[model samples]
Target chain A: MKFLCTRCDEVMKLAGAQAGDDTVGLTFSCPKCGGSFAMLTNPAETTLVKGLGVQVGGRSEPAPLMEVIQSSVARDTENQITWDPGAETRLANVPPFARPMARKAIERFAESKGIRTITAAVMDEARALM
Target chain B: MRMYHEVAGDGGSDILGQVGKMMERLAGRLSLIKSVIAVASPKGGVGKSTVAAHLAASLARRGARVGALDADLYGSSLPRLLAPEFIGANATRGEEGLFPIAGVFGVRVMSLDYLTGYGARASVAWAGAGGSITRGPVEASALRELLADTQWGELDYLIVDTPPSVGRLGDLTALVPSLAGVVLVSAPTLLAYQVTLKSIERVRALGVPLLGLVENMRGFTCDLCGAANRINVEGEMGETLSIMGVPALGALPYDQRLLKPAGEAGPIEAVERIADALLAKIGGHAAARA
Candidate 1:
């Protein structure tokens, strides 16, 4: 997408970019008027752009293939929820293929209740809620 | 309001140039492989994945370097069908790209299942406005990422197991510019034949070469006496093939042995036959062009 500077009737150049938790801020400057403009993207737009497997500003080094997928998977596991041994055992009962989703669901449940650690009792409660 | 001059190379982000570079990388990766074929069907439960896995195995058994890609994001069964033990296994990532897991007969395999950490049941939710949205673009981009990023290296053949949908097939064809051809799989039922015809039309519409159709589950083969028995009523598949001007590659009788895990037994004779015919067709097409 091209950005046009209405004040100077000149095309804007991407000056810089900053990535946030769920948003991306892009700064552009008009060469003719020396006017600066900044645009922020929502989470969805950020994801859509990230899905393109490209960076906002040109990268210093070439990105490895499947970087987006690798980062996304890593991000999913970066949450700080801890699982008790009993809860871990219970999670083992879930099919290996579904364990990731089950863990995510349980963690989300725990976080909703402001619980940091997931225990067998918490697992049972989450199961009951499900 | 004054006239707006569309400046060239306005020193923007150049997102389109990056996408073009990505495509160039994809093309470079594909160039190492001689043939890239997709086994596709329009509807599910027609044994498309089975055909794809066995086809790769069959080709690999014949001393060909084969790579199998499970492009079925939602219903990726090739991982289990090709390497059951590797199910839920994480893909090995190197500094350059992700490496495909070695399956039966040394056929390298890659699937989204490995990345998702959930085998086939993984729900691929996309981030959209306020909630999840339809996943057409996401799926396509994922496939493009897979095709562009996987360290497939050099191979004689790369068999892609496409999802049971024409849209996915189109996405794959568009993603891989070096696609050798496509093999459509269908069962012996009327519904399967109807859907297969639609897939054939879609393939032709995309202008990609249609290798042929494999009539999977044509009948059941009795293990005791080795007698082939017709399971479903034969439909107008033969007529449809003639009308569509597509060749009858081979008929794969439903064998219970295929249900057995990979490496327990080799690909059935019918699968081998399909593989041979596929090679011949691809060779013939290339020769004709040359």
Candidate 2:
């Protein structure tokens, strides 16, 4: 998206930017007339830009791989499943690569059964189902 | 007063530059891989995923470092077929990026199922102000992120199993920097042949090499007699293949053993032959390019 300074009939350079709770303000200045203006983006527009995984004003550091997905996915706390010591020990036995997936499966199994806390029994039940 | 004029660049966002960086990351990661093959078919329920899973296993059985990427976001069945135990499992992150889970035959596997933790039945709905209208762009972004993020270490072959859509095939071609080739899958049906021909045209138009076609479920081999029973009027598909000038890699007969568990010796012999033919075709294609 480009900005044209109608008063000066010249292209506007991005001067600065500020990100708010649900909006983004981009300030631009005309090189010919030294005039400036601010463009504020709505929540939806801000989200669309965010989804592209790019920063408004160039990025200082390269964005990490899958940063957009990793940030947007549901957090573990949102699921509301806690694990007991025994279950945690069992989970530790899984290989590091598969551990996260195993943990998610166990928590999902426990949640489906209306169980708030995951124990060794729940882990076994999930294993049996698998 | 003069008239206003639009600028040439993105004003300063450099969204295009960022996207270029993303593609660079993907290319840098894929540089270590020797061949990137995509098993695609425009029509579904034709064993594209099955062929992909078995092909990866077969390639690995040949001692090649293989990685199977389940590009089917809507229905990622490669996880269930290759590593059922890893279903509902979340992808683990590392200092570099997300890790691809090691599945059967030591083939590295990555899919949206791992990232989303929704397993095989993930109903991926992208909500936006435009409702269902934004699904295409959303899906493209998700695929781009998946390709850019997963840390696939050194590999001999990375076989991508694409969903049953010509558009998805186009997306893969556009996303992957240097695709080795594409293996179009087709059943022994006239309908499949028609749609697959269109896919063949699309691939050619994109200038990606076609690695021949695998005729799956062409016939059934009788278990008791050890005799192959010919299914579908033979020569119909042959005529079509001849007309299209696409090589027939091999015909996979319908086997009951494939329905059995993964470890229990199911169709490896047939799949190995197909794998060999694919390698030879890829070699020839590379030679021709050279």
lDDT of each: 0.77, 0.77
Which stretches in model 2 have alpha-carbon errors above 4 Å? A8-48, A70-130, B1-9, B224-227, B232-235, B260-267
Model 1 C-alpha lDDT versus the unseen true structure? 0.77
Per-model C-alpha RMSD: 7.6, 4.7
Give a tens-digit lDDT track for model 2, residues B91-206: 76665668888787778888887776444554444433333443455667777778768888899999999999766788888887478888888888878877887777887887
Per-residue C-alpha lDDT of model 2 across residues A30-77, encoded as one tens digit per residue: 999999989898866765666667789888789976766654444445
lDDT by residue (tens digit), candidate 1, B146-254: 8878888899998999988766777887887667888988888888887778767778888789999988888886779988788886576787698779998998887
TM, every model:
0.82, 0.83
Score candidate 2 by DockQ. Answer: 0.36
